[model samples]
Target: MHRLILSLLIASLAACSHTPSVPLYRQLGGPDGIQDIVGRTLTRVAQHPTAGRTFKGVKMPFLVDSVSKYVCKVADGPCVYEGENMVRAHADLGLQGSEFDVMVSVLREELDRAGVGDAAKNELLRRLAPSRRDMVQR
Candidate 1:
């Protein structure tokens, strides 16, 4: 009886250890998927007529990497975002509401194009929505 109880306890512990919920980063396809989305979004945004102005003369690779890390952190992934905060980062850009909207639209399109599930996409957007005020400088 003692051995049986010990075995049952061990089995339950193992099961619990293996049953951790998946993080959003994994749902977004891990590091690779997040990088792809950020890269494509920045590429298209840089080429946009109205939104392109902010990206003028910016280095693409660095921006992509930084933004990817930031997004991963936001999604509860194991990434360290050492970049500036939203308000500090965009403070000098003088970003308008229209430009911010364009960015959000492009991000939505990229998320859809990447085949992200509706739930994951919506969750990410919901998590990111609060940052808009810091990004859009009136």
Candidate 2:
């Protein structure tokens, strides 16, 4: 009886010590998932009346790839973003507060469409929130 009790205690301890290690990137579904969210968000934002003007003359594929890499990096993934900083990138665009808000709304919708959980979606948005000050000049 004592031996059985000891074995049970040991098993319980082992179970308690096992911690799952899931990164935020994996929670957001990794590179492919990040790409999907970024692409859909950009496409939607480009169609929006308030935000579409910012996308004018931009190269879609390059912008998509760059934004994907940025999102992946922000989500704690393995990709490195090689694009310009947010401020420098948006310096010429003269973005307004409403335009930024429109993009955020579109991004939130796309994230939902991609089936990302509320926790992951909120966390990603929280991380990216600081960039608004840099992107929105007006």
Local error of candidate 2 at residue 48 (angstroms)? 1.0
Q: Between which residue pairs do clashes occur in model 2?
A: none
Top candidate, metric lDDT: 1
Q: Count clashing residue pairs per candidate.
A: 0, 0
Please, what is the TM-score per model? 0.85, 0.87
62-128 in candidate 1: lDDT tens per residue? 9999999999999999999999999998988999899888888899999999999999999999999
lDDT of candidate 2 vs native?
A: 0.90
Error of 1 at 124 (Å): 0.4
